[model samples]
Target: MSGSLLDLVKALPTDPSWGPPTTTETMLNGVPYAAFSKGDKLGRMADWTTEGKDREGRGGRQQYNQRYRDQIYGAGPALQTVFNIEGQNEENTFSLVDNSRTTIRTRGFGRGGGTVFRGRGQRGGPTQRGGRGTFQRVGGRGGQQGYDNRGGRGGRGGRRFGWKDYDKPQRNREASVQPKDSWKVVEEIDFSRLTKLNLETGDGEDIDDYGFLYYYDRSFDKQPGAPTSVKKLNVLERAAYNITTSNDPVIQELAERDEATIFATDNILSMLMCAPRSVYSWDLVITRHNNKIYIDKREGSSLDMVTVNENAADAPLEISEGNKDSINSPAQLMMEATHINNVFPLQTVIESDTAKREMPHEHPFYNASEETDPPASKAYKYRRFDLSLEADPEPLHLIVRTELDAVVKNNISGEDQFLTIKALNEFDNRAQGSGGALDWRTKLASQRGAVVATEMKNNSCKLARWTVQSILAKADLMKLGFVSRANPKTSNDHIILGVLGYKPREFAVQMNLNLNNGWAIVRTFVDMVMKEPDGKYVLVKDPNKPTIRLYNVPKDTFEEDEGDGIGMSVVGEDGEE
Candidate 1:
């Protein structure tokens, strides 16, 4: 029997509705706010950051900060900005700035060969029988007299021993851990002070509180081409520059390590207006002692004081459990430590494009009869820079060291310098065409080293761009002598973006190079300084001054020019070679 009964009713059309706006936008902590899909906030906080205002100490601001504190703790979206020639004017798009690139792109496939995580012991099955039975006996004669030879029979054997009852030798297992001395004196180092302090003011005077020190007893001679009227810094201004640029001995030691192979590049040292809010260090170690108190080991390089015990080791002090997670050692504790080590407090901008571009070049015709050669694309620029104060450099330096080691092993040429532009170009080309699989040589660099490097380079670019956007930001720097009026009248006019007023100090910028395996060249002690203020640090100007200086002693002792002018150098054919 087939029976089908259905009640079908049609309803009238209704007006389109979004259903009460799935989430109503509340003012970010009581101030008018607008959240963009890109994770950027257009609100009072961003406005206050750009303009001059006291963000801390005030009741509402403090409460507002505490309420939305989670914003800074997570990895925020990658910072990106576009620099293009505006329709209004294409001629002066990148004026008063240096254009150069440093690139490192390596491709391969495989997981990184680092320590892996495994549970300490095996899962449960059956408990092994415990007794000193050196050897399992088969029958009644070999069995002990008092014990049951058969199943539950104390005397003569009713049955022989079974295979199920035998116990195998238990293997003793241990994990590969750092020697006790590595963490013996667990000290709680306070790294909170390591971050930029009193950053709001941006005045030279506020720098003293953060333990910024200079390289005393060392004289840095001004290069010959430096501007005539160098902005003679005030006492506090000089001190501030001294401290920020001051060389840290620990950083120096790390760079000089026998394993380290630095390749000095053109764009290693450059300046930015604002620093990233937080510096992360995965290598930081923390430990728990019998007292239940935690200890921390500061791993990355920042200009912070390190305390040591009388024994000359890091002095351990008590820390809160919250901080225990920032430590790196004791693999068992790694998962727990991730929480504290992952805070991002401020959105960091990192441009993915390394500005690695190709310039078209045609072979010059020596004879009239020769056919015109087609234009070829040649590698023009590549940059590798990162803003990580602590953890970033370790991976970067390590990658360079490994790359150099490979060149040495291959020994393509009799020279020590094996890393070359050709090899780097090949890497960049291969990386562009390949998917994201890291081989042994590139595994570590891919996961951390390259990422950190790119972030730093991108952030520096962002900071420079932001500096010009806000007059208040430039004003603060001007008050501190970082930005000066070119003619004292132009000070009220448009500001120059990259005119750095201060001479650069302690920057650990190094690169390794092997151009055609000629010589394994190591260029170290490179720092980026602004073009010496042509008659003091000027903000505004008639004709713009040179912006950047790529300061480094080349591997060749014979080269006369040590610091190349970034802005002065022209790019195309008729320009400086």
Candidate 2:
């Protein structure tokens, strides 16, 4: 390396948008640890989130540590922006790389712990033999069988037993009787063998086990806990996507390949945000063009100033917000996207008929034989989002407002459609308790104590502002789950009979139910409109009478800590985004 003033540099663009660098070091379990604390090292793994599930035997905790849905979902802050959804991609099953990971080692506890043999205990308590002495009372000389006795010191404390001294002291002094190692230290990294999806949905919907999180990821953002920023997708009516680049090899490679930036807004901020993962410590990768290095990031000593030195590295390929002209005016960009839909890895550019109206162009990038099937056009709601042609482009979103009358009318007769989803089951990784399937595997409803409503704003032109009518008519419904303990020391130990914390989640299927064709919707309305919810609760399931139970886990209790929450984070606060 050169003895230049700028020894380390950053490759990611800070201007567009990067997630705010994270400093809080903790597992998805809220267990805190230093990011680089050597004491917390678990071999080659440096920043691994957790080991596996341990929520049963050890007081509701499992022998292993596992990542929470939010932890996995939050990992793709950058990916969230470019992708359709964010959350555990568990069922989708994939690896960061194209091929399955090459290593796997799964070690689990044997079943002997739970089995018991009848007729006798493992060993009778204690036995006494050989020359046992008897004691006699001595008052005056010949009162009664007078005798004094002393017995051997109660044999060896052989095989001491009980929960406390569960296992007796063995021969080896160096051997440990109590285990202090967390299962984390022995966790196996089987490459990509196991199936688990860690993602956050860009759209508001809880993952359904049947095929939830099957959606591919295309975005990555770095920011958390700020005014929420959403993922960006090309609508059926939009042409062209955005990409940002820097001189660093990693950054350039990612942009060149259209990999979503970990810092989501990189397409917007120009050079202000920070990327999450980095190759080295201290500083991030900066530019390497023209033989000079630009300022990479805040240094330890002086977190503020930049010292621009001579031909130290290469002057950044003269890139900065002040320069770089490939970006067209927002007006030009917007005008260009009136229509066009595309997928990746294409040598030829495919433009739709709608795109031709906004920006006419002959198909110059492809051979006629290479064109694939055209995508069907979906309805574009410019009127809903309140996008204005007169305003300059900015980072703010223009929330769309749809008219209730138009919405209802469109629902009944319009051709445009939206995606809808309903929950059928939940996936439990802990597999706690007994009864193979029910112990840790069951699909139950999860949501309630929430509200969903639409708000309308008045604008003189009616198009100036708008209203957002929630797809669902009412919210705060109910759902169920297994596992009762509120804060078990171990999640795996939380073995139980049934679902504990039951709540209602706002489950909506974007694909509208053809109201005219479905009578169930009509029936639900009868109950809703008449405030007779219980009138339809008791349904005949063959003939057996089943009892209904209502209970709440202490305040912040969860079902399986892995997915334990009032509502899976996918459904927002109050089950409304």
Candidate 3:
């Protein structure tokens, strides 16, 4: 028998088809085949107890087998086709529901490391957990408390613990004027788009000048926040007017003569130009007649009111929004600020009929025969700016009614220098919406630069508007008064800290205010109105969004309100009511 086996082996080696199998013959029946290394460990072909053993934390054979499967076979495309089967099997249908908690390691302070064990129904995925009490679980129970990094219990709303300021109530301000059903939406513009526009206009030329200016009181320019410099803010009764574009007699006269294609007051124009920096809502009425556009504000519009910290991160809250402090409310603060601005300029000027600088024409809006009180120190200059482009067939022009508050004689040149006066009021630094302002009483003297910078940040919109107005009027100097409350709790009493003077153009450069961008904004709006037919339009900033909307309405839109005297108040020549 041994002799017969040796003969058969010798015969197999000699035969071509029966010798050791060639590399090309790698299939058995219809199954693909591949060679495996002898050192690789083989896993069980069928394990029905894996799910039960894995529940007891002893089995995860599939995961372990997969890790080595790639290492042993190299996981290349050529080998993958030879090893993997195409048809479905029992392994594909098998499913294991894992109820076991997961253990995750996080970088911990001092020690080997930290381990965070997740409960079965925890929502968040595996992530690092640090700090003493930082484990947070969600969606398990309704009122269960969780620990936060700040060592405080989480609220029922699932809010993470931190500073209590995160709990600030939402601000839901009402629109300046609600849209009526009869109004049709014309265009909607975002502030972001307005910021990119730029159109350079020439230094405006004075079309006509009216009213007179009182000489500024140099005493207020002393060291601000000093005990000697502080003065009580008094309520002065003077005839000041803030007439709209169409109502002004000079603008009407100019419009009749076809002086310019557009007309707006300095206040209304500045607001529209600085629309990108504003946070609060305001509306302007644009009446398009023939080919002219007139920008006007509503009678009792918030545009006339000076806002307190309107650009602050935590702006003054309304009383209806659960704010306990009524003095710090937005409405009360606006009223206080408006009162200060109205009376501040009046007080800062030396009121003498002889030492005043009278314009070419008499006071446009003030009437001594009809009024008992003397008119406030104000001068209106109707300036014409060229807004024409080279591509246009006709030159476009804009006439803006600009105002000056006081006049000062230049000591060097012996020439009269015009000035625009505005006041910045401080409520309370410790208040909720103080915008991280310094204590004006204590720091204004020592750190005036820091205080002014803080005010610039907190009141960017207000300051920008003032700067724009000062530049619009071509004032030689812009006077900013730092006024603070006599007591933090009292809104009625205030004291002037000091007055800081700045040249309008230089101040505009410092504030990074681009007049070209403002002109571009004006021209863009003018073009929009010019394209539409003769009608009444309203341009309104959205209350809760960074957007402005243009609406087309009937001619008698705000007429009823004006006739009834419901929401209209006459603003004086000093731009105050």
Candidate 4:
């Protein structure tokens, strides 16, 4: 506490990286002490001997208070009684020394005319032992009274701010209901209007065909009026501009009434372009059945991709152009022609009775070590989502599908194969209807709107993202198998189904024809291919009615098959060749 140690102070280095002084132990007068310094710079020193005495005094005072409780509240006994106390209390209070003082307590009108303190340890002189109000107790200070500096009956306790509030929070009151929060009001959208707009295809493909389904999210920016010109506009920019320029009264009214900020590179650009933001997108599923195509649509939000700070609405928004494929692939020009757009491969689906009846262990690819058995035998069928499961009796899917030419390559053969793929698309149906898996999501969009400023306590996207990712990761194209009949009007007409088992590639085999239903039952197997006379591997084709083409032998072999059993043949029943 003296300046005499000034000469002992070390000169500070000019290096800016070095910080304040640190403490170390040293001996002072044959007793341990704490010296805070950097090098020779003396900052502070505390004698261990004096520290122990200070601790003892605090313990003595606390003991005195407890022993004489109920006599004068915080007031303790005489100094002699304090020194006579025994061992320290179990819990330490970080008290250094025992100092006694008196505090004057004056009653003030609090809420409901209840008593409150005017000041703590103010306007009072020290008193002897056993005196009332000797130690000042901290509480609400005097401002206007009623615990919150309010005078009138209307005042409860200032205002009850949220935990996130920067101002002082008012004391809890039982009489008041919770305050209304404005941030809870999410932006409103008219989903129906969006559905009418022709969706933009990123790859410039004409998707405005008859069987295409379209969905629009209402969360996108909707500016009023038309732009003066149109240049340097993004995809969303162009669309928003067109919408604003529309003569439609509804569109004009929406544009004119918005009180929010409008930004653009030029007067010609659209509001969405000037202030870039993620727009609402949809998942489109196209189905082609019996040569006719059908489409289903569902709405999804891209708001999460645009991080908003609700705390500061006017703050510059941080945009994260997340994996565009997962958001809206068709809208991105590059993804339109890729196989990544298709989530399902219909051609690979196996359609055989054997698959339905046999076990996974019995399949040809059943390698217990590799676990690469066929999906059908393993019960790994593609998943289908049905909205009817929620309430509608009919099923619905949020899955999206697009057509692309996928390239298949063989590593060992160095052969590249290009195949047309009509499969599932990356964009999936999410936030469908209003219940079950999408319940929380619908509620969040309803409350938080399209832009969220802060992190929500309950994350609703986890489930939706999982659903989409699972469908993408687990879907694939598997080979198909089928069983068929060769001919009718004959007994013992047992014929092997389409393509024999994957193994044993010889052409010589027995045939059976059961045409009871005009076509025999077809049992399919994976890797079932045929080797023609020219040695080319090809899929087994369906047999034509009235005739069957046998391979790898002379034309007259069918007439003389009973000899070698290695050539083509056409025989009636009774095991005759």
On TM-score, the leading prediction is 3
Model 4 RMSD, rounded to 1 decimal: 32.6
1-577: candidate 4 lDDT, tens digit per residue: 3332322333323344676543332446654333434444432343333323243345564554444432322212332233333223322536657666445554443434444333333444342122233332233332233323342332344554444646533322121111123212111223232223232111111111111111111111122111211111111100001111122232223235431111111111111111111122211112222222222111121211222111121221112322223222212211221221111122222234432222122322223474332221121111122111244343322212211122233347845322222211111123111011212222223433221212211112221222222222232221111111122221112221111111111100111111111100100100011111222111111111111111122223223322321122112122221
In model 3, residue pairs whose N, Cα or C atoms come closer than 3 Å (at least 3 residues apart or on different chains), thus clashing, are: 240-572, 240-573, 241-572, 241-573, 242-571, 242-572
Q: Residue 90 in model 4: shift from native, Å?
A: 25
CA lDDT for candidate 2: 0.20
Q: What is the C-alpha lDDT of each candidate?
A: 0.20, 0.20, 0.80, 0.22
Ranking by TM-score: 3, 4, 2, 1
| Superposed Cα deviation of residue 443, candidate 4 (Å) | 39
- lDDT, candidate 3, 1-577, per-residue tens: 3453224333432334543443433367877555332233554354444333233355367566434433324223454644544423545887878856776544332222223333333335565344434565444334434554554534544444447777777787889999999999999999889999999888989889999999999999899878899998877778777677777778889999999999999999999999999998999999999888899988778888999888887788888888789989988889889888888999999989788998899988766787778888889998999999999999999999999999998989989999999999988899878888998888889999999888888888888899999988999999999888889898767899899999878877877889899999989988999999999999989999999999999998988766332222343443345
lDDT of 1 at 463: 26
TM-scores vs. true structure, each candidate:
0.14, 0.15, 0.73, 0.17
Whole-model alpha-carbon lDDT for candidate 3: 0.80
Over 214-299, each residue of candidate 1 has an lDDT whose tens digit, in order, gives 11110111221134323321111000011111022222333444322222211111111221111111121111122111111122
Of candidates 4 and 2, the better by lDDT = 4
Better of 1 and 3 by lDDT: 3
TM-score-best of 1 and 3: 3
* Candidate 1 lDDT trough over 10 residues, lowest sum: 398-407
Reference-based lDDT, residue 277, model 4:
18
User: Which candidate tops lDDT?
Assistant: 3
